[model samples]
Target: MLPAPSRPPRLRALAVAAAGLVVLTSLTGCTQIASAFNGLQQNAVSTPAPRPAVTQAVSMPYDSKFTYDGSVSLSTDVADGLEVRLDVWAADPKRTQEWAPDNDKTFGFAVNVVDHRVDEKAVLTQKRRVYMSMISITSQVSQSTIGQQQMMSPFQFSADPRTLVPSDTMRSDRGLLLNTFQGGLLVPTTTIHQLPADTYGITLQFALQVWVEGTANTDTSFQQQTVYQVLPIAIFSPTTPTQ
Candidate 1:
């Protein structure tokens, strides 16, 4: 059996938020969204999660916006703490533009879709540290081993196991937020796609690429592991697009 995640209070909040998201999604007719990781979780020295602050952006007329539920945890390998850290990424205001700017834009990221260009060259330093490799796993009926399963539609991504801090320094532009943009007026999260009602559950894998210290981690090992929550995905189109 795998060890219980030392999820912090903030992470719990996000987990709850993620749950709430599923409920809200039901209103629009969604299904349980889950992740199936195709890797092994190592038993290394784990660290505490990170505490995130919240911020929101609203429209007076549209009544459209979201709240950032800042919740993250810090995992480590070295005794002192995590040696290498995963670089941070800020709100990509131009994300929609990169893909179909004229296709009606919204400030949010979603799972199972990579419409945006996803600036592979963009890099930003986080205020605190990046916590990743947060995987969700399931145990066998009567076995002392791990399960082996693959996601139906796995999004290819790379992330470092631990947070990183440059020994020397970096450029303002090349810092964490590549373009010096602050986090979204709300929190940046993965939006789930609704599935058919006839389906009991579907496997999903969300990948996040991290630049441990350089451009980004390319290996599939250091990425976050474990199968996350198994919940419903909220399905809804943008009520109204913001110009």
Candidate 2:
């Protein structure tokens, strides 16, 4: 094997100088790189949180036979708003059980959509419809010591554009009012749920969702409103009728 050639002094010195320059450059660039990373972290932390979405809740009166008559309306700055009304009545089934010999038995309630409308301003940029997609009813009953009984999706109430009809106002005006929609949601008594007895407190909750028109490329603006009413129910008891 041939002996390794010894490096020239000038070349060795030049190599040492290059190594020193690399070390110097690394040391100088470290602070700038760290500062850049820190700036990004700070900027990320300083970003503001988003605003909360719009939601409204209203309470309704209680009826032993699950009857409600009310309306809820909400307005916005952009001329897009929603209005809903319901007048429901429960029929006396006159159902009799061996346990209770009474004639004031109620089977279920009937839903009469008094009025539901969506008013919006004209948006020439995009085409849209004031769509009322769904309606839900929730029932809850509380007893003295038996805890509480709640049903999240009790009474399946469904509505759509087909269930609604254009109002007289919308017919009078042409394309000028592209955002107005009006109709009623009528639910038959067959769709309602039967009431149970021997409960301290009973409540019925109603909710509806609507899709409002928005910008062409952006997602639609959704608005939902929920309202509940207390149900005055008197439990039938042979031992104690008021119980």
Top candidate (TM-score): 2
RMSD in angstroms between candidate 1 and the native structure over all alpha carbons: 19.9
Position 30, candidate 2: lDDT: 33
Best by lDDT: 2
lDDT per residue for candidate 1 within 1-243, as digits (tens), equals 112224346444443443333232342221112111112222222232332333332222211112111112222232122232111111222332121212321122221100112342233332222223222322111111123222232222232212121212222221221111211111232222222222222222333322222222322222322323222111122443323
Off by over 4 Å in 1: 1-8, 12-80, 83-190, 214-243
Tens digits of lDDT, candidate 2, 5-42 = 23335334333442232222443443443343333323
RMSD of each: 19.9, 31.1
List TM-score per model, in order: 0.23, 0.35
Off by over 4 Å in 2: 1-82, 94-130, 144-182, 191-197, 212-243
Worst 10 residues of 1 by lDDT: 62-71
Q: Lowest-scoring 10 consecutive residues by lDDT in candidate 2?
A: 169-178
lDDT score, residue 233, model 1? 17
Scored against the true structure, residue 31 in model 1 reaches a CA lDDT of 19
